[model samples]
Structures are given as structure tokens and as C-alpha cells.
Target: MLVLLPPSETKHPGGDGPPLDLGALSTPELTGVRTELVEALVELAGDVPGARAALGVSARQDGEIARNAELRTSATLPVLDRYTGVLYDALDVASLTRAQRARADARLAVGSALFGLVRGGDRIPAYRLSAGSALPGLPTLRAIWRPALEPVLAAEPGLVVDLRSGAYAALAPVAGAVTVQVLSERPDGTRSVVSHFNKATKGRLARLLATTTGEPADVVGLRRLLRRAGLHVEHAGGTALTLVEPAI
Candidate 1:
């Protein structure tokens, strides 16, 4: 199965890999849009204030704008290693066994506003675009990405678990892709979507699915696996699966 993750707004700085190369990324079909978005970002970087407004970043994050300016020439890191935030922290890739890591490398990928879809091993420089950010001189990111990215995701052969947030998911909605929602069940029998902690929960769940020996062919198997892992899972209709955790 191909497990799709959302790109973290935060990233770890610096890497030893060569500079960004659009052609070197996985999903070669996306190179055209990738180049377009990357060039647009680089061009936008020329005006730091303009870029700051466009990217919705504070003056304190001017350094991030610099990262965008240097995207093409900057050193790169593997897609998985580059993104750093609560979700990635919970994924805890550093502790995985070698074989598990291999499984992760093969099964994991991230949805990016700047790069579209990047596999775990794809090396890319740090970039600051978010799914909601509107780059000047281009169509909405949804318009730019949906036509190019949706089909690529739609074509994946195995089960696809999309762990992206709603904005990111709008860039491309894979047909038949299984979506997961984390909810917390209360003692009073009330339930609601968990916010902050669920990203970490999703991370741990993604790690579980990626490292395990068996692959889930469909949503049924996927739910079975999550249940086996001691999660309280239930079908939320259509292609959606809900994971319930006890309320804190």
C-alpha cells in the first residue's frame, strides 16, 4: 500500500545531498507542474515582503523565504527526513529497525504544495509553500495541482491511505483512496475529532502500517490491521475510516 502523508510546515535545515532536481523525483509525470511551482516560488522570493505576504509568514520567518529563494541550488534531504513537526516526531523513523525502515521507504510518500507528490527517498530542498498559499503569477494551487496530481494518485495500484489534512487533500483527491479521521470517545459517550494529538496518532499509525509485514489490500483489511494494533476503529461510511481514542 502507498501511505500518503501531509508535508509539515516546519523542516529540518541542511542536508548533504545535491541540489533540487525535478527530474530526479519519483512520479516523473509530475515534473512539469513541479518545475512550474518551484520556479514560481523562486521568482516570488525576489521580493521578501511580497513573499512574506503571499506565504502568510511573519517577518521572523524571513529565513524561510530565503529557503524558497535558494530552493533550486540549496542542498537537499530525503523527503521523509526533511519534514519535521509533531507528525514526523511521532513517526519516529530514527528508531525503526533496518528492515522496517526499508518498508517505510517503499510504502511512504508525502503530498507537497511545491513538489506535488514525493516518495520517502526523493531528495528535495526545504520549501515554504503550504496548500493554502497562493503563489503570484499562477492559478490557485488547487487548480495547478488537482489536474496533475489527482490522476497520479488515482493510478496507484494498491490500497492508499491518505493522512493529509483537508487543505492538502484538496490539491488531489484520489479516487477510492481511504481517508482516516481520529476521534476521541468520552466517558459520557460523546465523540469528537481530536485535533493536536491526532497528527501524532496518525504518525504512529502510519509507522505501524508501513513497518508491519502484511499489507492491507482494502479498507476492510486496513481496519482489521488497525484493530489488531489495539486501536478502536469503525467505518465512517464511503471510503472513510474513523479511529477512536479515549478522551484525555
Candidate 2:
């Protein structure tokens, strides 16, 4: 008989509010956090040597691919124009070498970690974190939000952006408070995980979305936007909205 494991849940303690008290975090502590995050990302890549190359694809490029595919296959254009800019920028910088690609990957990994931490209600000094300097014309790791987040926002405008840094800061956050559940699906089945965010963070994100798109950051509005962009929105648990797609 095949054994099935129970659904697993992990909750990270939320961080404090902004002007984040890094006082308790020593240099070594920060370094340790960064190192651990990088290692975890590398492991997540799961690309064994001589197996397959990890393209270190930029989030911006990924967003572009999604947007372009929508344009070709769907009847309407993406309601969010920023997606086009991100896609073009990603295409322009796709020729970097492996070493440069690694740097970009590192930034992306770190940026993701920061975002996760903030979403969990931690007070993070986003600018202080060493995501490294911007690569001139190249898109930064924060661009991941476009592809990873925009679809979700388009589906559930109620979801909020807690902390925005790097390229993400330029985009507005969505309004309202909503729960986010990240899920991983394998050959066997699917598993879901929950993400934590405080009310303040939700407010910040909603304000960003409202400002950027000139649209109300609500579930109905987001769903309309996403559907117009040729994306499918899945509503689960009545309140949770998920954007269905292949692993990012």
C-alpha cells in the first residue's frame, strides 16, 4: 500500500515593524542569514552537475515570456503595462556569462529571502541588506515580483506587498489584507505552505497597487485584470486566490 503523509504547515514568526531593529542582529548573524538563504536557494535549484544547467533566468525575463505568450494566444493585452517593460529589459540582458548569471541568481535568491522574511511580519531594513548594487541596465533580482507576484495580485488584489526593495520598490503594493499560501506540486501530489503578513504590510501593498495601476486593489478587480491578461485565477477556501502555472 502507498503511504500518504499528512499536509505539513510551517509558520515563521513575524518580524517587527520598520526601522527594523537590526540592533540584535550582529554582522555575523546577518552574514549567517545570507549564507543560509543562498544555500537553501542552491538546493532548491536541484540542478545536479552533468544533469541540466540552471539557466539562472531573470524574473523579468520570465514575466516577459508569460506576457508575450498571453498576447499571442489571448484576445486582450495585459492590463499592467509595466510587465512589457520588464520583459524587454530581461531580453536585453539575457546574454550575460555564467559567472554574471550566478551573481544575478544570488541577488534573486537573497531578494526572495528578504521578501519572505518581510511577508512573515518581520521588520527588515530592506535597503541595508546587501543585494549588491544594481547591474546598470540589467534587471535586478527584485524583478521576480513581476512574474511571481503580479499574476497573484491580478487574481487577488486583496493580497498585500509587505516590503519592497530593489526593483520591487518601484512597483506599488496591492491593497487589503489577504492570506498567501505557497504550494509545491510533485509527481505524487501537491503540498501547500502558508505565508504570514501583518496588517501594516497589507496596507502598504494595497497602496502600491492602487497607485501603480489606477485600479481598486480588490479581489474582483484583480481577477478581472488577470483574466484580461489571459491568465487563469483559481479561488480556493472562498478567500484565497491562486494563480495556476508551472513552477517558477
Candidate 3:
């Protein structure tokens, strides 16, 4: 199975690897658009005030524009290693066993606003861009990405589990991909969709799948695996799984 994850707004700065190489990313088809976006971002960075306005950032986030300026020259890290926050903190890739790490490298890819999609082992630099951002002198990211990215996702073999947030998911729609929703289950049997815990649950699930010996190939198998892992899971029909978290 292939798992699709969203990119984090915050990234761990610097890396031990080589600089960013468009050709080295997972989807070669994305290089053209990546190049375009990179050029626009670099150009926009030349004008700090303009860049801040376009990126929707305040004075405190001015450093992000500088990060964009040095995108190519900066150090690089493995795709998963670069992104950090609630979801990635829960995934905690650094703590995984070697075998689990290998599995994660083979099975996971991240949805990026700048690079399109990158596999776990792909090396990338810290850059500032979001699925919702509209770069100066460029078409909307959705417009630029959909044409090239959608075909690449559709062509992938095996079942896909998409864990991207709303904006990133709009960048490319994966055909036949299963989606997951995390819900808080209360004593009265009512449920509410969780935000922070939703990401954490998905991260934990990603880790479990990465380490498992028997990988699931479809929604049914995924549901079974999640249940076996002690999750209160329910098959929500049509390629959707609800991981019910007990109310706190």
C-alpha cells in the first residue's frame, strides 16, 4: 500500500545531505512545475514586502521568505525528516527500528506544495510554500499542480491511503484512494471530528502500518489491521475508515 501524507508548515532547519535536486524527487513529472514554482518563489523573495503579502505572512515570519530564497543552496534531509509538528512528532520516525524505517521508506509519500509528492527517502531542503499560497506572477498552485500530479497519482499501483489535509489534497486527487477520519466517541454514543488528535491518530496509524509484517492492500484489510492494533475502528463504507477515539 502507498500512504500519502501532508507536508508540515514548519520544517527542521538544515540537513547533512546534498542540496535540492528536482530530478531526485519521487515524481519526475513534477520537475517542470517544481522548477516554475521555485523560480517564482526565488524572484518573489527579492522583494520582502511583496513576498510577505503574497505568502500571507506577518512580520515575525519574514524568515520564511529567506528560507525560500536559499531553497536550492540549503542543506537537505529525507522528506519525512524535514517535516515536523503534531503529526510528524507522533510518527517519530527517528525512534523507529531499522526494518520499520525501511518499510516506511518504501510505503510512504508526502504531499507538498512546492515539490508535489516526495517519497520518504527523497532528500529535500527546507522551503516555504503552502498548498493555499498564491505565488506572485504564477497561476494558483492548484491550477499548476492538478494537470501533472493527478496523472502520476492515478498511475500508481496498489491501494493508496491519503492522509493529506484539505488544501494539499486539492493539489492532486488520487483515484481510488482510501481516506481516514478520526472521531471522538462519547459515552452517549455521539461522535465529533477531532482536529489535533485527528492528526496524531493518523500519525500513530502510519507508524503501525509501516512496522507491520502483513501490509494491508485494501480498505477492508486496513480496517482489520487497525482493529487488530487495538484501535476502536469502524469501516465507514466506500473506502473510508473511522478511527474512534474514546472521549477524554
* Cα lDDT of model 1 by residue, 1-248, tens digit: 99999999999999999999899899999999998888888999999999998999999999999999999999999988899998999998889998998899899999999899999889999989999998877789999999999889988999999999999999999889899988888999998876677898899998998899998999999999999999999996678998888888
Q: For residue 143, give model 2's deviation from the true position in Å.
A: 30
Q: Write the number of the candidate with greater lDDT, choosing between 2 and 3.
A: 3
Ranking by lDDT: 1, 3, 2
Error of 2 at 62 (Å): 34
Would you give me the overall lDDT of model 1? 0.91
Task: Supply the TM-score for candidate 1.
Answer: 0.97
Worst 10 residues of 2 by lDDT: 1-10
Tens-place lDDT per residue, model 2, 1-248, is: 00001111111122233323423322222443434333333343343221122222354334322322222122321111111222223222245455543332222111232232222112332211123323223344345334443333344323332223323433323334333333434455664432322222222232223323334355566556646655445655443555443232
> Residue 143 of model 1: what lDDT?
98
Which candidate has the highest lDDT of all?
1
Candidate 2 runs further than 4 Å off: 1-176, 182-214, 237-239
Q: Each candidate: how many clashes?
A: 0, 14, 0
Tens-digit lDDT track for model 3 on 40-93? 898999999999998889889999999999987989999889999999999999
